[model samples]
Target: MRPQLRLLCDSSFRGPQRSRDVASILREVDELQAKEIVLVAQDLASYGKDRPDELGAGSIVDLVRQVSAKVPRTRLLYLYPSDLSDALIEAILDSGVPYFDLSLQHVSKPHLRRMRRWGDGERFLRRIADIRARAAQATFRSNFIVGYPGETEDDHDQLLSFVGEASLDWCGFFEYSPEEGTYALGLPDQVPVGLMHERIAELREMQDAITAAKRDELIDQTLEVLVDEPGIARSHHEAPQIDGIIRVPLTLPTGSFASVQIVDAQGPDLVAQGADSAS
Candidate 1:
């Protein structure tokens, strides 16, 4: 079986020169006959925000269209940073792959301001609802920082509430680590290390339950999964490595698409068996 290709597009890729090179990149990938392509970007929504003309397109939506035209047969997945917008969400849904990797550092309004990011829990929840409304099978993954400078109890509570309400398919919580020459390092009221650990533990516990329940919901349902290896497969709901995997029989060949019926849920992973079709 051919190996899957992962294309990493960093912030520099958003520039005009690099943006224009996307076509050639797609052409190369096509020439290689890659069966699957995972497009990793810092912020896909900001693809052409800096200079649309250089991209030869107005937005990421146009880029998605271009990819589909160029590699219609290959499966495309996106791993992007959290800079979501209505248009970007629409574009992702249009791509027929509804997996979302939102890098929301934190969601409290004040803490988000400190983190130099935008959007609060309320705004994010609304967007999640909108996506779910449009695509019932959509899956979401996000990461959050637990203890930033000046993180208050209220802020923590807000994050807990958001975790409960969002019901994301996957979540990661990390204790803040001050980096050299960063604004956060100079901020006052740094959270104690012990407190940071405690906060992260609480957040992880809540999200774990949510993730388990989400996985449980898939039991008895059939899905089209791409077998990564002898015993590991993934449906559209699971990303390549960061999310849970669908366990399948060893008889399934690697890198082949198969229909499987989910027979059991094991926390983040699901067990499946060969099936004729989705039901």
Candidate 2:
């Protein structure tokens, strides 16, 4: 049996037809008996924003509640967008899933403006703190683009500072790539490719250390993890495929949930022993 099933419901999941479409899909998957159902979307919080659902479930919070009620047996998860409003953040917290995959390109306000995004470093930090305050075990992941057009030394420093302060569970730093017909292509002061590489390397190193430190904190803690395969599993703190995985005994069955105690931290990944074997 497959460990989990992922449904890619992008921006197309909108308008009055959304409810019927979702119902149909859920009905079809009900027989699969998958361990987890991950609803992958660009901005799940923005669901039904432009067009309200015909059934009166007009927000992501409503959608999640509906799905949970329908699929009470399977675990549900979704991806988050970068531009999260206060209402959306509250909705996410209420859903009882503390994992956040914020697609924030950059935290520097000036740089974000250049990228046509929102939120500054300070604002992002405050929001993150609020989430943690509400859910101590909450996990956060975000991506940043290094060396955007007109990116200054101060902007890069601000990003570094934010990474240290935020202490996100997962982070991805990519060098800026110019695409055809994009606004960045016409922008002046494009950073050199070599400098972009250097900047990304710095970000990667700093974030790697932070991620390792955070994972180390989980050592000895008993967690209920879902085994994806014979030797790989993950708790809510780690997303499937994208984030680090937990190494379990080969005897563990795939697509099964087991209680494990984290035994060691291997940088980003972790080593865990079954609760029965843990000392």
Candidate 3:
């Protein structure tokens, strides 16, 4: 069984079929005894013609509690999955879920318009910053697409700056992959593979620096790091895996806690010393 699993609400559209569907999913998750789950109500936002039932107040609270209590380590991740506002986000986090995942393609509004993903980089980053300010320990992640057709060098630069500001824990940089039946597929002058790879590399480098700085900001701070065995030292920005894991570097007799010092920085893992004779 995967340590992290997503319990996604198949539909977030406002319809009789979706309203109570999420609650039912929870029941099944409990049956399976799933402890850690990332619950997402995908496409919660308005998708063209239909405005699905917005993840309402009471409903979101109920769902957050259901998953949190049932699974101690459970976290709820909000996706472009719906039309939720800052109020709804605050309510949801207040309700229990502290992890927020926003889908952001590019910082360039023009690029976003081309792709048809609503919202600009500024607005989205503000929301994420707000969320982190509200909940410091909250996990923030986002995905961006590079090399979209008609993307200029300026567009890529803007994205790099935006990533620096966002300080996202997890940032995914994707080269534009055209899928059949989508508007992007019909677009002309698609980006070349070599250029796309270059852009991806640039964006990744910027993100790497931002992540390192953010992780360094957490130096010497106590965190209830989740343990992943067979781990090694990396950097403050990195954990065990690419996605990251909380590393406690002492050989524990059993599962236990140790005080660690942030000694170095790697991609996303932390190099720390733990469990000395002295505290």
Local lDDT at 230 for model 2? 73
Per-residue lDDT over 1-279 for candidate 3, one digit per residue giving the tens place of the 0 to 100 score: 223555354452334224445656677677766434555555433222231454543455456556666764455554572355665576456533466666666778888888777777778877777777878777677788888888988888888888877778778888888777767787877889999999899888887787777667666765544343433322222322346544455563223333456554455655555633221
Relative to the true structure, candidate 2 reaches a TM of 0.85
Task: Arrange candidates by lDDT, descending.
Answer: 1, 2, 3
lDDT of 2: 0.73
Worst 10 residues of 2 by lDDT: 11-20
Candidate ranking under TM-score, highest first, comes to 1, 2, 3
TM-scores of all predicted structures? 0.87, 0.85, 0.75
Question: Looking at candidate 3, what is the lDDT of residue 216?
Answer: 72
Alpha-carbon lDDT, every model: 0.74, 0.73, 0.60
Top of the candidates by TM-score: 1
Measured over all alpha carbons after superposition, the RMSD of each candidate to the real structure, in angstroms, is 4.0, 4.0, 5.4
The deviation in Å at residue 156 for candidate 1 is: 0.6
Candidate 3 accuracy as TM-score: 0.75
Angstrom error of the Cα, residue 243, model 2: value is: 0.8
**Model 1 spans > 4 angstroms off:** 1-8, 12-20, 56-58, 70-83, 274-279
Residues 257-276 of candidate 1: C-alpha lDDT, one tens digit per residue: 88899998887889896522
